[model samples]
Target: MENLPKSIQVIFDKNPKLSELITNPRLISNSPFIFALSQKLNYSAKGNEDEYFYRIVFKEGSSRELMTINSGELRGLPTTTCIEKGKISDVAGLERVELDNESNLMPVLLGISLYSSIQNSLSYISNLCVDIRNHQILEGQARFERISETIVDIFNSIPDLALDKSLRDAYLSRIVKNNDDCYELYVSQREQLRHSLKGNNPDYNSKYYYENELYLFKDKLLTHPVFSVFERLVAGRICEIILSGNYSKSNIQRHKDFISKAESDINDIMASRISDLDRRISYYKRDIEMDRNLTRDGIEYHNTQIEKIELGISSIKKQIFNLLGVKLSSFDLLSQLMSKDEIDVFLIGGNLIVNDMQLTSDEML
Candidate 1:
């Protein structure tokens, strides 16, 4: 609060409603101001827009807190990301005002809060170590700026699990006895999965959070815990590696190469997936056309079969007429045999023998 200029504080004091906006959803939501603030902190590889949290709070009163996060804008919301509050416009005719100007109340308060939270959270997460068991790791979408705060929050929440530099490094690179390898095996599995799902069915779900909905997917076999110990350990180690300043130019170049290779691998997977999809679509389409052709051919074949059936029936009818004139008792007994399905039974049996011979011939071929 003291860090904020008196001029900004005065505007914030005038607007009590501003501070009330600080809640879990607001803190975690993807907004430009939050994104900018997260950038200011540099805690993780991701940015604030990609990050999410259950909730974040201010120990102080809501008024100052709102002003802090809002930064300089006195009247409405943040102008940094082009989002303004008050549902009003200014002299610019753009329906928004800049916070750098003290006339607006929203920006000034919001900016300060954003900065304060990031700085405090970074210092907080830095002090603690990581804890993991299964060697599983979870990656956040937020850039280093936003993720740093959440990492701190997670560390702050679970103070019991702690690790040092050596342990942290071990956790990141360690291989658990669990059959799944984090880098190679799991990555391959993810690739295989991504490959298997490459259709552009317009009616299919296209939500950005669809992938994150691992919990709702009935086919999904597993989902990462919101803050798994294994994930924490990996993150801690990675943070240490980035902050260490121990890497030479060669090592940094090696890391850059790894990133390039990873991106290339992903692109290759996607390309192959598209090609596979096109091939499958082609095959299915061809089969459909073939079915149409077969149907047209089948009409003629069916007509020919009907003619043969009619001839067979005619022969049976003539034989029955002859039998009616002779041995009527023996014929009545034969009629009671209930052998109407004899032809169908014989056809099924003969087809099985033909199918066996065809299979044997195909195998030999």
Candidate 2:
């Protein structure tokens, strides 16, 4: 459209992609806006198979003003309004005549601009995908740190107790009378210890046999009801001591309680982090789909990227389990991370490898 602004003409020629398209009448005519604009203007067209070119001249006193279309569906198109109003009558044309839009060049410019925007949007998606995916691994590792520390603290806090000689002897006597298997194992073990200790020249001065037998007695005590009851009493005492703010007070029950609480907290933390990654991934997918240039290959590549993140999520969960001995069947990382309310896995780093083979859906109790 010759009635269109001269600056708009510059936009078409400056963009290589748009310039190439406008020179191809067969391609440009396919768009309805371009076809309509071409009919409205008086233009001479020329071009070969490789390119089409056109020039348009407005008749003196033409009443209509050329307008540019702005539609979201055609995100690439630049608006003709962007050009200065005073420059609309400036001359624009190609020396070579071909099927061209002339004033209708606005559509071609708009299409190219849309394409550029799409590329930029796609690029954003690609970059964001990398971070969102990596975040999955990072978040899990953070939770792992907390849970593992709690576990180590619990294990280290267990108190060591000394058994009295008389109490030990009494517990052993009951175990020997009641549990035949335990009694047999203890006796067998003591005999083996004696056989080794008394070899050739036995050091008689060392009460090594009785000492070893005493050690065996402790093992036997584990099967005695009295000793088990005593162990519970010790645990309760330790818990009380710890709650009283005594540093030296250590209890197995306290440790167990702490571990249980830590485990629950860790589970909640992991669920929230995984959910965060999943939600972002869903958004990424939606934005990616919005790009008109999206290809099957592009989608497949991104899906593979997502799979890598999912595998990473699984690996991190396994690490947490290994560190804390807490495995959750609900944390089945193999399930699709993108599924609503399901695991949304994300990973960072291109060189990440899932080295552990222990990732399975089985509940590790």
Candidate 3:
């Protein structure tokens, strides 16, 4: 529990298997048993304002003898406790022995407990978003328009989480897949696509739905690209004209013409570009479909590998904890090993399952 992050501890405390012990049911705020205990014993703080926890010092008259305080009461306690006894595996040769009291002990123990979880929570959320984004994107084959803001926001959060590089790559692909899906969805809505593409044209372009429509829609799609420096500059220029409060018809007309030309140029270029875009989209769809299939397969494969690797890590952690009777981080373990290239390192921890390496391969076979 000391080694686990709060978020992870919360996750586990909610677990049915571990709940009875870690999150044992107790009388909460209104219970008389709580009031009795509060009046009777000293509580070492757990350091969270909303979350309360107090340690019952095992002394002559400590109330823990009568009733053990559960996590419900323990959640709101701060880290200002004066008790001290834990070895600092977090720092090298870090050992402090004193008459254990509230003022010193809480920071050392609670700090490592708290900070570890925060970094882990960020990773957990980032991973979950990546998985959902990937799943949505992979399944999204034909649709290409009306992409939801939520999808975009989650995709954007990948980088903000400071996630490992591999997950970042996974998220980038997911974003592209979603964009492609939206594109497919847009083209499927023929009438709506047609109207949007018509763009205030008094006379509608009554081209063949499947034949010229693909090219035409492609052109229109390119016309409304979300951003470009030139278009931005044009917008800025128009804004400058407006802020000057010159509502002169001539000035307005002049700026309007410039705006019209920019729009026209974008539209014209898109029309020509759409022809190419149609081919590109078709080609991209097939290529992306293949890539999507491969990526999903790759993700599954890597996830399996990651699980295997993490299992080894867990084994390593358990070994260290068992040997030292304290949790040492990966870096700490590596540090203890120093520059040794290959360590036929002994696995020491909670339950060290020793393998009979003495058994020959032939004997095992």
Candidate 4:
């Protein structure tokens, strides 16, 4: 507490027991809160211009006693209350102090509660990663749901100190990176499962039955609000700089090149799929003709298969209709002149286009 703010020092003086708990070697070693605070203090001591402070408030007379933690700049007077009247009882087995209207112990209690939560979340995510690696799909999905909720709760308890570059890089960045790795692991497991099932079963219809389940699992985790926040914490600044036109000419050219390559890859994949579908349709037609003594039911099944294949081809053709040459070139040129919001709209529209192509591909499969 040597470089701690005077205001925090005053609070410590008023609450000696809380100070003792914070300085305890065991708690300090295991505490995320202490780790983050130490990082912030070290950075401030290095003569960084930004000053930070934390304020804790306890409210009485409610059905559930509430505690709030507000933190932000010591100057300019702007503060964000990360935990607003959160239920104190949410922390297990914590007894309230009657001294000084229970304010003396609230800060320590809050710290312990948040530390436990973060530890549990990190551990749970680690186990989920293991489950994913072992191909325990259902078990992994269940653990993910629990971890997702736990992470949101942990984030809500902590201050916006995560917004600080130093604090984010020290702590939250690990969680973000872990999430990215988990997603990749999930995709790899899904592919492995798909291949395993395909080899063991000849029914193509049931071969990909698990595909939607895998896709939904990935979608649910990535689209979680807390997960999105974590991603933004990791990459939002760079994205903002690029969108704000603060990037160099080379960066812009790189982006254009990336988009062009993506478009070309998509077109090539679509062309290949269309050719495969055409060959399948031709095979089914020949099967129906070559089996001259075939029953009416067999003929009907072959015709139905041909109709589905033709429909898939039609769907793909419609998607790739205006996307090949001129339209893509115009899109590349127009993106350069577009405003930030317009660029966002264009990117969103592009995702929708890609999603449509994905749907077409899934239907064909």
Candidate 4, pairs of clashing residues: none
Listed per candidate, the RMSD to the true structure in angstroms reads 32.7, 36.2, 27.6, 19.1
Clashes of 3: 36
Tell me how far the alpha carbon of residue 205 in candidate 2 is from the true structure, in angstroms, after superposition. Answer: 77
Per-residue alpha-carbon lDDT of candidate 1 for residues 302-332, written as tens digits (9 for 90 to 100) = 4454454345434433533332212212212
lDDT per model, in order? 0.31, 0.33, 0.33, 0.38
Give the per-residue Cα lDDT of candidate 2 at 102: 49
Better of 1 and 4 by TM-score: 4
lDDT of 4 by residue, 1-365 (tens): 55444555565678788554555211212133333444444555686625434333324432333333345544444223222345234321232212111233233333233332223323332232333333324435554444344344334333322223343334445444444544443444434434433343222344342343233323432222222222222222222222222234555455445445534544553454345457766777897889788789988987887786676566546645433333333323323332222111001111100000011233222
Candidate 1 lDDT score at position 91: 20
Model 2 Cα lDDT, one tens digit per residue, 1-365: 24224544455456667544443111111233233333334324433244343434345454234435556686654332322353454332223333333453433333222222222212222232223322222223343233223222321222110001232234334332323332233334334333433343322244353334333323331122222112222222222222222222133344445444534543444444444445545644775778778788877865765565466556656654533342211122112111213211111111111111222244222
Which parts of model 4 have CA positions greater than 4 angstroms off?
1-136, 139-143, 146-163, 170-172, 203-280, 288-301, 312-365
- Candidate 2 has its poorest 10 consecutive residues by lDDT at 346-355
Alpha-carbon shift of residue 187 in model 4 (angstroms): 4.5
Residue 234, model 2, lDDT? 23
Candidate 3: lDDT over CA atoms? 0.33
Higher-ranked by TM-score: 2 or 3? 2
Most accurate candidate by TM-score = 4
RMSD of 4: 19.1
Model 3: residues with Cα > 4 Å off, grouped in runs? 1-146, 186-266, 269-365
Tell me the lDDT of model 2 at 257. Answer: 52
